[model samples]
Target: MPGETAPVGLTLALGRLRALGAKGLRVALPIAGHPLGLSGPPEFNARALDAGEAVIVTGVALGLVPEVFQAGPEGDVHSEVVWRSVPVREAPPADVPSLGEAERELAEALREATEVLSRLNVAGAGPAAQAALEAYRARAGRGREVLAPGYPPRALRVLELAQRVGALIEIAHGAGAGAGEHGAAVSASEIAARAEALRPVERTARRAQVAAYNAYVEELERGGS
Candidate 1:
């Protein structure tokens, strides 16, 4: 393995720490590597940090460094472990919230946004709809345009649909191993697999939600007439 050293390589490091009288110290391991040159150290460190566990990341020069800091609260040391990185060639999405509990949150955001929109008020609904639509698009593999500008009211409608189905799919996809223990930030491959597993449920939910919303709106408009 290009990045995987013998367990002894790391075990010796731990032994050094112990010999140095390091106590209550937590050690993280980079379990795997990818063909893209990315490694698992960062994710491992993130899990450790999230658990409020104290860690001193080592193993740089082997493409693993802990220079990056994901700052913590007062008196707590915070940092990021980078096993590998590529320079940004393009801007990433504005945000990517967790899709683990996304469906439940999406459902709530949609309902609240819908209620606001139904009352012909859209100010607070923007943020709400944005959250729901983003979660939906994440699972459905659609882009962020589902929550784009120039369509605040319609975006709320779209959000409602996404919430109903996006959450269903999110829940249907079981948690990956170590997900709970790792604070839900696992390896890239694990995250990708979880998202892929959600696609079908998300798609089905999307279609049903759209059709149902359109029908209900049409009926509402007819009643108003």
Candidate 2:
């Protein structure tokens, strides 16, 4: 059951709550079909403990956890027996940065790369080189837009890295094209020099992206634990 996909409603609800930065959520178990929300087999309520536990485990795996309630006519007997001894909350260390903060750091690093590209002086460079530079600038603009908030932390990191890498490659290609078009105007050494200057900025962006991704995974591990 752990390997199986969670029911659609549970997945959607959990995603929504995480996006909203909610804490201390609770859910009623043995969810029935239609108006009651997600449905399981007829024996769902009979195996409420196992089913409910499975859902919670799955949620934890997805970087979220919700308190589950399975009350009957007497009320809360299940919780009293099972969850009574369990600690309800634990605060993370104050120094631990949130996913949003990590994302911002990565975005800033990528913006630095763009700034380096924009400042490069390619005056008198041939049309081919100018075209390549323009393309790289356009990609940089698009990358900034993609870095905007809303996506899950991991997804956002992946997207941002992809955008930066693409732009970098395009810039490299443009530099090569410029060199070829204006063999006299721009020496091969000039193109190489420009690329070398960009290398550190690109490396910085990559390092920041990796750090952000690691922070996100660590947060998930802590939440699951």
Candidate 3:
């Protein structure tokens, strides 16, 4: 679904806030066209700011961070303006999937990707590729660790997907490198070429993660409805 524009993440964030009984929360965002000093028409800028604010508000509600803030001009003119919120309150149960199930699924995906890279023997690919593979292994190990309870299911799913994205990046970086039986090093050009060849794998993994996240969001939306 290219160019799809469902604000599922933001919607879930707001839903979480409401479920947790948050009231009158105020969030500040850059006035549209003046983001970091750029300028655009007031109407366009306002819409941009509104969209950005939705994301920040959602993140805060999801307990992604303690809070979100912005320090910029007020109304695209004043020099000093701020928007902030109180710390995130506890999330209420929405009866989504269990954290353990999410962790297992993510671990399985990472394992499959790891096996693919291992069979490719990317360590012989080049120093950079080897380093990337090692990093991926470490990250995958961390991602497979046990999950604790109490977080919202949607938030947990997003976190798992975030970890999967990181692992996929490393996999992409190490895509086309393998050492010979003699343990010879690979050329940089060959490694780059191999990475290009493996682009499809990376792309597929990326799409799968995105689809999973979107599906979770859709489920949340349906439940809310």
Candidate 4:
């Protein structure tokens, strides 16, 4: 078109491309009225296109229609009159998983983590929490069972740290879809603070148990069951 802008149309076009399963695309717009004329007196009338799905517009002017003889001089398709616009490339296949699925999975993770934290708060849950954590570890080792795929040892350590704190003080689901430039960041400070508070206590308790085990082991070595 004559004076068409590119933003809205480009965004919509990109959406269509995404729907078409394109992971990449390139759009080359004519530079104003010409397909190749420019301030830089270059030869071939156009610059080589760049990579990745980005839109580029060249501003050469076709002024008045050039002679048809000049159009396909050396097997060239079009006669050089002034400007020419190239069609946008189709998008590549969409290989990533659905964003909706990503969101749902994230939500479920938040819920599961909080549930685990909640269970750590009961009166007699210390030993039980330890046992559960051991079980959880065993089950997790068997396969990708909850928490997150390829769960890390640190994350479990975090869980154990949370258990010591009697309900990790911070897990929260922020309002709205957690995606975008203006997306909210959930704070881990509160949970961290709670964990810090319980860390000393937990460490102390853990040390005591370790000491008791060591004593028993020593006795067993000395012929004590």
Candidate 5:
């Protein structure tokens, strides 16, 4: 069923989306307590928050979150992806910094993160952390587009920097037992210090992502698109 919302394949879900008179699409990346990229009715917000990622149909006030599973006799023969639809309500886009401002702020945040990581000896404290950061950087370099066509170059710049910030957060969070501010070995003051340095950077990264994702939609709203 192309019209069916749940238990729908990727192709059918896309067909259903095309059937809707959507003017645009926006990506939402939300975490608990901070609904970063969502502009929603409570139902849509709750679902996007639960899933951590979703796509909102611009003119339709509808959202889609994907749920993936494996299926087969042993539940491993094939993979399935379903797009679950949630009704959304119109809301203003989140207030995000301008591209230049975002770039400058992120540069400062990067310096701060680097200082903290250096002081704490956390840059490569764990091999996993280094590997993860490298992987993210590699992916960003390869993929190139932060959003679809019609967005400004600055939007892509912000998104890439934001991704690096996310990688920093992961580095700080993925350390081993021997790493400072990790596991039982962490001191209370050290843990607090780490959080203090990283929390704002994390928020900044989310803000940047929101700006990048909303760039095209904002343009449309402003008659630039």
Candidate 6:
């Protein structure tokens, strides 16, 4: 809104959303071959893919993906963020796994990924990267709400599993790619295989994340919390 002709205001944005007869927001995480939660007009899908995320307003044909602009010199740089709304189609939500199913799938994925890494002899990262990974795990383990209050607790569990899966993906990619200074690169064959194996898990992680983010809206649509 700040970049618009009328200038910025949250009220203006809310009013526009209300005028659209909005029901709730649905999250989209799109990637090639997998439009995770998007059912779209190509324009909206393309923008969301570029942004790597979007929010579609259910019960209406509209979506918003944010873009940030930065300018000015280093010491006094300026930046602005805008949610660029795009036209979308109102379609049935993408079929995503339930929390229980996600958890089970994530668990199996974790096991398979671990075995793959271990078999390929790329399971452990360099000391520094290992420490960083441990720190991240500790942070994730802290009791906290993964989403806003309106979302059910199961969403939190799914989010946590998704994050764990993401961590595994990172570890696989990092170890395979020789990320840290002290890290040794795995064989090209292993790297290729690792990537091939983790692709589905990575997609699952994205799907789970979108599901968790949109869970609140799903609940609202069903007339429940």
What C-alpha lDDT, on a 0 to 100 scale, does residue 181 get in candidate 2?
49
Name the candidate, 1 or 3, with the larger lDDT value. 3
- After superposing candidate 1 on the true structure, give the runs of residues whose Cα lies further than 4 Å from its correct spot: 1-164, 168-185, 217-225
Per-model lDDT: 0.37, 0.43, 0.42, 0.32, 0.73, 0.73
- The 10 consecutive residues of candidate 5 with the worst lDDT sum are 176-185
lDDT score for residue 169 of model 6:
70
Candidate 6: tens digits of C-alpha lDDT, residues 1-225: 223575456577867677768778788887777777777888888998898888888766788888889999989999887788778887865556666777777778778767766765554556644765676688787876668776798888889888877876776677333333322344676657767877877887877787777778777777843
Tell me the tens digit of each residue's lDDT in model 2 across 1-225: 123344345556545546545433222232222111112332332244344421211222122223366676775366522221112123322122345554565566566555545555433445665676677677666646543353355756654664565455355436456335431225677667666766655544443443343443454566778
Cα deviation in Å at residue 61, candidate 4?
A: 91
Q: Which is better, 2 or 3, measured by lDDT?
A: 2
**What's the true lDDT of residue 173 in model 2?**
38
> What is the TM-score (0 to 1) of candidate 6?
0.85
lDDT of 4 by residue, 1-225 (tens): 234354235456445445544432212212323221122213222332111121222122211111223544567666432222333222321221222333333344445445544544422334433444455467546754223333344333433433323222222111122232111122465435435544434333222222222232223334632
- TM-scores of the candidates in the order shown: 0.21, 0.35, 0.35, 0.19, 0.77, 0.85
**Clash count, candidate 5:** 0
Q: Write the per-residue lDDT of candidate 1 for residues 18-57, one digit (tens) a residue.
A: 5544332212222122112122345533443344222332
- Candidate 5 local distance difference test against the native: 0.73
Candidate 3 residue lDDT tens string, 42-139: 44334435545311222233222122445557766534222222233234212223334545555555665555555556545456566655676786
Error of 3 at 211 (Å): 2.5
Model 6 gets an lDDT of: 0.73
Q: In the order shown, what is each candidate's alpha-carbon RMSD?
A: 20.5, 18.2, 13.1, 25.7, 3.8, 3.2
At residue 175, give the lDDT of candidate 3.
41
